[model samples]
Target chain A: MSPSRRHSDPQPTLATVAERAGVSRQTVSNALNNPELLREDTLAKVRAVIAELGYTPNRAARQLRTRSSHMIGLRFEEAQEGTSNATMDRFVHTLVEATARTGHHIVLFAGDPDDPLDGYDELLRATAVDAFVITDTYAGTPAADLLSRVGAPYVTFGRPWDDPSARHPWVDVAGAHGARLATEHLLEVGHARVAWLGWEAASRIGEDRRAGWEAAMAAAGTSTDGLGVRITDNVDAARMAAHELLEDPTVTAFACASDTLGIGVLHALAERGLRPGVDVGVVGFDDSLGAQVTWPGLTSVRQPLEQVAIEIVDLLHTVLSHKTVTEPARMLEPTLVVRRSTLRDSAR
Target chain B: MSPSRRHSDPQPTLATVAERAGVSRQTVSNALNNPELLREDTLAKVRAVIAELGYTPNRAARQLRTRSSHMIGLRFEEAQEGTSNATMDRFVHTLVEATARTGHHIVLFAGDPDDPLDGYDELLRATAVDAFVITDTYAGTPAADLLSRVGAPYVTFGRPWDDPSARHPWVDVAGAHGARLATEHLLEVGHARVAWLGWEAASRIGEDRRAGWEAAMAAAGTSTDGLGVRITDNVDAARMAAHELLEDPTVTAFACASDTLGIGVLHALAERGLRPGVDVGVVGFDDSLGAQVTWPGLTSVRQPLEQVAIEIVDLLHTVLSHKTVTEPARMLEPTLVVRRSTLRDSAR
Candidate 1:
């Protein structure tokens, strides 16, 4: 049962493939990397030999010879807001899968968030990663500038909000669209007094989500005059704020900025002995893992993590291939997942 | 504000440090790697110049010269059980921090769960990582064997239960000890009919946790006969099994194998209109991020992830330095965190 006792077979090298195919070293190389240069019959013969021998290309050797590692660099930042951080985890999972699907692998690294460029510099000097995919870009972030200064190929998963005209490639989710979907869903379910719960910060992402909520409420022709609007991202703080909101008795539902705040709304309801779906409808953004198993299943907005990963990889590959990205900044839509938290009559 | 329009300074190289320190390139290199060869004043002067010049060593060039990458490889497997997988995430976070503190970095990769060595092979050939820190190893697992056959240095973050005598370095958390703590806590809080919720599998980890609960019950002189010991790791599946357990009405508390299973217990109690802390108490193993946010915060066993991360890095470094590891397989203790979920009279 212990295979450690046996001698291991050496991995098949280019020489082995060349010897098996009865081709010169250059001919085998052409067949593997520059197949179009060879005749159809020769290409077909070399391909058959490679398949029969089960020879895999050596990426490190190729990188050494060509100065390009088929690896993408990703920096895993420490979770600052620890409670609701699944969105980044989901992004990473899809990024790894998507990168692997395209004959590339991700090199995960952690850097000092305060001075992230130091980590990037070290990785660039030590490894053969061809490009990088930067996540969680914010206003005045130095990652894009550092990558540009060093002439390293990279793509950010967040927009360059500090400077829209900056020459960098990025992809971001439309948070405003996600917030509107949540607000509209609550309104459609006959909630007249829909209060907004948002983060108390001058964040671009936070502003986008709040704008969506305001627009949806205005379009519904409802006077949100007495609606309770609490500003704080902490769940406990949101719960405390909700206590005051519940005193009015006119607030029927809450449209939260994220699932973390939505959880707080549920806590407030439980405190007052108010049923979630029956007495109050709560909707949240970023359909995190917490929403799935919550007592009364949360209704939330789900970002297309898979598609976002694919787009980021595709865009990075474009830049690596020396092709201009037509639309440097791409925005994707978020979908709504309706659950028992909003479905009052459906007894599931 | 417009960094894109301004010119940036180039990263400092070894030559820059050497020039600043009024020393030769070889002297600078010796100062950084082998300070004992130089006088104390010379060594201090070189380091001061290096800090001032911001000269970071080139990792790739050093690997080519020395055949060491100073990196530890880690493979991230997709969560098969899906829900309640925060334990692995916490491990990753801590691992990154610990590796960085030792002037080393981690390389994250993904692989097929059924066949993991393929990913390791690919990474070994493509990068210059010195050693690997393997997590989530199981009985009859081939990762250790495959790595051994290739003569690759690695240390697992789990015990080698299938063969305790296997020549390998590992660091593991005492799962049975954690479970025992949880069970003892429940018993101390006046819970006589405390049932156990566990996964329905022959997992070494699962068995370890089960043994702790059994040992605790035996010590208390309580007959655990007909105790609701449902075996399903899935949250919804556990909830279904919990319905039958709750029918007995005498089961006042539960000691779950994991936080994921504990979440299911919470769901089951909510279904029966029973308050978590008031009517019944629930304790979970692995104080995961989910435990902190769940309503009535789950009481759980907190694994020392930071210490575990530190031990793994320290052990791998020892192996890389060709030093003898005193204890090949080290096991660490776990602490129990009491929260509102287990407290009957704590009003939030």
Candidate 2:
């Protein structure tokens, strides 16, 4: 379904409302903008005609010109001290930059973090957003189902977790590939018993990333027993888990599912007076601002968020142009940013 | 000037464009939506007239209906990890929520980090945004200067740092008061020689916050020799400065201008095997997400960002309605959130 398509009826203008209500164009204008100027009966009659004629006084004008609102709807997620907040924030900045080139701008709406459907429904009712860019599909994409049912144009930043064949254009970073790179680097640096501090198995992204660690460990002919730990993604939880895992002296490196977990490891090391990048190695995902600015600087797998944003905008343009998407999904590669946290040769 | 004010020339519509071009309404519509339907000469004639008549095909329709675009322009800052990023991010979320109630939405644009005036000029030229919500005015607000010259409406989140009698409406948090609260709390908790870790002297926010720490220390009749330090606002610089400051055993507490600097203190203490909130107390400003979720959570002075956002929106409505603002500057007080970093009662 083309996102820009609307009803074929001739759009009603101010003149049409004026003619239907048996009033001068000025009277109709006053009724719409400054109803206090009109007699009560005259205002009522003009308003009823506007309603009966299916004239949306404000949106009608936009529809008449472009057949679309050049605005793209995006839900600005809840503000929190979060690992992914920095990642999503940077991506949004790039998306804003990319959309500017096409004369389309992003309209950010606040929504309940637990309810992905909250802001989207309200935007659809109140605004003429031409399309939407959906994100945070880690649990599941109820947003995709809702948008598909409504025939609204949308592109997601994450792949549909449950269904690879979902009929939507999406751009996702290669999570499993990113984790594998981190594991390979740790192994190359002479850490055979590399641990994986990951999110709970239910998170699709966590599982995808963990799979890479598992594959890398198996390829290196290393036993994976007791080195894989699943926990909540917050710092305190990761810190406690990594602290306990550090008791095993053989586990000399960690490949983490998120920067939060990586930061947790740094804290755990600080408690024990262990020097990171020398005593042990760690790598985090998302390359968040938190990862870059933290003390000693966390080594992380940086998803190509800028490229993903550009690709998302390119897909938006395609759907808005009513062009068929030959390829429904685009996955970009993730690269590693080496910092002091993972440099084993501390002097180098 | 009222933000909604514009040139009084009658808005040109499709009918006007067609009449001037000696063509039918349908022909003009074709020239706009399907230019290939007309001969090259006719298309050129229609285009020339459309441009000359100032029929901003897409924007003119909106101008005709509301006389104001229901969009507010905001420049999304270059995403960075800092003490203020989370503060500004949360403020933006609240602003978006506040604008929604008034049938307005925020349009985010990206700009060069060093140039404050870049995106505003582009947004003014391209979009029909009714007004702008200027953030990051701590760097002297060149944007305010540009917007004032162009007669565009704008409200800054930060007060005019260099000018007390600036003309624009602004909503700013009470930085000095917040720091005073933090410093007083430290003194009340058995810390006499409290030290101040702040930004360089040139940063207006840094100086404002530092004044509070100085006031609190002096009010308690404490000497401040070798107890005040300033550096660039980053984790590494703060950490290094704090480490050197810690050589003085009498300076057992630190009140910092930012959470970034406060976290640096945590790092410095961790390296020295000193306990934060036990052997020493630490306090940060802005209560950023980094402060909230960091290990041994940082005690921080929290700006009333959500209330500030609401106030900014209210100011915007006043200007849009062409009302004279009797009071243009509104300052909200910041409160302190005590966490593990400042809790000397460890068992509690």
Candidate number with greatest DockQ? 1
Cα lDDT listed for each candidate: 0.78, 0.82
Query: Given candidate 1, what's the lDDT at residue A74?
Result: 78
User: Compared with the true structure, what per-residue lDDT tens digits does model 2 show for residues A1-348?
Assistant: 111212243556779989999999889978976999999999999999977765545443545455577789998875455553466677888899899888688988877667777777545533347899998798689887777765778999999999866889999998999999999999988788999999998999999999999999999999889999999888888889988999999888999999889989987987777877888898989887677666667899998888999999999999989899978799999999998888888575
lDDT of 1 by residue, A55-105 (tens): 666554566567676678778765533365466677777788778777776
lDDT tens digits by residue: candidate 2, B214-257: 88888999988889898888888888988888888888999999
Badly placed stretches (over 4 Å) of model 2 are A1-63, A82-84, A121-127, A345-348, B1-63, B81-84, B125-127, B345-348
Which docking category, incorrect, acceptable, medium or high, applies to candidate 1?
acceptable
Real contacts recovered, all predictions: 0.29, 0.33
In candidate 2, the residue pairs with backbone N, CA or C atoms under 3 Å apart (3 or more residues apart, or in different chains) clash, namely none
Tens digit per residue, CA lDDT, model 1, B251-294: 88888888878888898988788888778889988886667777
DockQ of each: 0.37, 0.15
TM-score of chain A, model 1?
0.92
Best by lDDT: 2
lDDT of 1: 0.78
Taking all chains together, each candidate's TM-score versus the true structure is: 0.90, 0.79
Q: Note each model's CA RMSD in angstroms.
A: 3.7, 15.2
